[model samples]
Each structure stands twice: as structure tokens, then as C-alpha cells.
Target chain A: AQSVAQPEDQVNVAEGNPLTVKCTYSVSGNPYLFWYVQYPNRGLQFLLKYITGDNLVKGSYGFEAEFNKSQTSFHLKKPSALVSDSALYFCAVISDTGRRALTFGSGTRLQVQP
Target chain B: EADIYQTPRYLVIGTGKKITLECSQTMGHDKMYWYQQDPGMELHLIHYSYGVNSTEKGDLSSESTVSRIRTEHFPLTLESARPSHTSQYLCASSEPMGNEQFFGPGTRLTVL
Candidate 1:
């Protein structure tokens, strides 16, 4: 079964500082990784995905994630954090050879202090 | 933005009440999914539909039931609402073989 793990329950960073939210996955086959953001009382918004492309995938809202094959990780990063960027981030994975539904990790809350 | 939509964005009901959460998508996607999530928590897939008339249970065992009577509609029904069923329910859709699944705003259901 494909699964995703987000070790950190929460991450705190000051506004304008670089931020990284860690994510790791386990899949029997090649993994299709994705990142999503959720605001309070709102549904998840898609960020970016890694299929079979370049390791570095740029996403909406000036965010990017690196797909590390050897490490089995896909960590979300931003050059500078904004107060508005604070929200819950989720990491999801689906195996190409397994069921199409995504397996999501426990979300990591991002706190950006102004 | 994705065209997926869910109705009753916030619902509060009493125990044993019957309720149905509605989900619809305008993208003509072939797959639709229903997920249960506590606030700021991980998502649990409760049910999904391949297309019209094709519904399947997901990884999580849910007391709710779902139906896909049309290509664009996938509604979930709970026979008996309980406190344990209180959570935000999310609806999503994706085209066949598509990598990304579009999400709805979600319905926050609270059973008292």
C-alpha cells in the first residue's frame, strides 16, 4: 500500500524567511507525489505534482517541491514565507501501479509570524 | 480553478437524523471521490465512483453510503447521523488517467 508521512506536526517560520515542509513516501512502484494547501474552513487547493518529470517542480503561489528519488521524499519549499502563506499543508502519494486514489499524510500546520 | 462543488457548506444536525451531502462537478471528469477529514487533519477516503452507476468503498470504512446516478453528481447519504460522524466532508473529481484531483470547498457536518 502506498503511504505518505509528514513527520512534523507543525512548522514555524517568520515572515520573509525561507520555509520547508518535509514529506516522505513509500510506494511499491513509481510514485506520483502531490502537494496541497488548505485554509481554515476551506477545502484543499492543489499546489503541484511530480509524475515523471524534473526533480524540481514549481507550483502555485511561488512554491516548489523537490522529488528526491533516492531519499523517497518530496519536500515543499518556498524562497520566502509570507503571513498569508500560513496554512495547513498536505502531502499525498499514489502509486502508478496501484489504485488511483491518493494516500494523504497527516497535515503539517505552517505558522508564519509577521 | 476546478469546478467541483459541494452543498451545505456547514450543517448541524441532531443524532439519528438522516442527511445527504451533495457533490457535483462541471469538468466532466470520469472519477469522483468523497473524503472525511477532521479539521486540520489528514483525509480519509470514504467512497469513490468511477463514473455513472459505478461506486466503490474506499480505504476507510464509513457508515455513510454514496451513489452516482449521473456523471456529474455523487451524493453521500448517512442513515443515522452521530457525533462520531461529525467532520468536514470533501468532494473531488479527476479525469481518467489524470494526475490531479480537483476539490470542492467541503461540507462541515456537525452531529449533536
Candidate 2:
């Protein structure tokens, strides 16, 4: 079965500092990876996705993720974090195995302190 | 803008009551899904539909049942609400074989 793993439960960083949230996946075929952000009492907003080609995919809100095939990782990153960036982040994966629904990680709480 | 909407943004009902959570999309997408989520946790897919009159259970086992009678509407009904069913229910839609999904604000249910 295809699954995603987010190792960190929470990550704290200072405003303007670089931040990273780690993610890894296990799939039988090529993976379609995605990053989503959720604000308090709000639905998840799509950040970006990696279907093919570029290993580094850029997303909304100045976010980017690097897909490492050999390592089975797709980590979300931002050059400079803002206080408003504090939210819950989820990493998801969908393989070409004919499954329509995405397999999501446990989620990581990002706290960007001002 | 194309959007998905969920009704009863907040609902508090007593246990054993029957309740239905409604989801609709104006985007005309062929696929719609229902997901359950706890606070700051992973979302579990409970139901999905590829089109009208086509509904399927997802990865998670859920007591809620859903129907897709119209392409734009997908309503999930729980015959008897329980404390375990108290969570946020999210609705999403996408095009056929599309990777990106648009989600609704979600309905938060509290079972007392």
C-alpha cells in the first residue's frame, strides 16, 4: 500500500528564518506528491505537487519542495518564514496504481514565531 | 471563482440523532470526495464519487453513508450520530484523473 510519513509532529522557527518540514513516502510506482496547508478553522489549501520532471517544485505562499526519488522523500521548505505561515502542513502521495484518493501523512504543526 | 461549498459549517447534535452533511461544487468536476479530520491530524477519506449515481467507499471505514444523485451534490448521512463521529468533515472535487483537488471550508460536527 502507498503511504506517506511526516516525521515531525511540530516544528518551531523564528520569523525570517528558513524552515523545513520533512516528508517521506512508500509507493510501488512513480509517486504524485503534494503539499497542503491548513489554517485555523479553514480548509486545506493546495500548495504544490510533483507529478514528473522537476525534482524541485515551487508552490503558493513562497513554498517549495524537493522530491528525492532514491531517498523517497519530498520535503517542504521556505527561504524565509513569516508569523502568518504558522499552520498545519500535510504531505500526500498518490501512485499510478489506479487509486483516486490521496494517502496523507499525519501532518506537522509549523509555528513561526515573530 | 470555481468553488466547493459545505453546509452547516458548525453542528452540535445529541447522540443517536440522524444528521446529514451536504457538499456541493460549482466547478462541474466529475469527482467528489468526503474526508474526516480531527484537529491537526491526518485526513481520512471516507467516501467518493466519480459522477452522478456513482459512489464508493474510500480507505477509511466510516459509519456515514453518502449519495451522489446530482453531479454537483454529494450528501453524507449518519443514521445515528456518536461521539466518535464528532470531527470536521471536508468536501473536495477534481477533474477526472486530475492531481489537484479543491476543498471546501468543511462542516464541524460536535456530538454531545
Best by DockQ: 1
**Interface quality of candidate 2 as DockQ:** 0.77
Task: Provide per-model DockQ scores.
Answer: 0.78, 0.77
Docking class of 2: medium
Shift of residue B94 alpha carbon in model 1, Å: 0.9
Question: For residues B1-112, what per-residue lDDT tens digits would candidate 2 score against the true structure?
Answer: 3399999999999999999999999989889999999988899999999899999999899999999989999999999999999999999998755378889999999999
> Considering every candidate listed, which one attains the maximal lDDT?
1
Residue A40 Cα positional deviation in candidate 1, in Å, after optimal superposition: 0.2
RMSD for each of the candidates: 0.8, 1.1
Off by over 4 Å in 2: none
TM-scores of chain A in all candidate models: 0.98, 0.98
Candidate 1 lDDT tens digits, A1-114: 899999999999999999999999999989999999999999999999999869999999999999999999999999999999999999999888857599999999999999
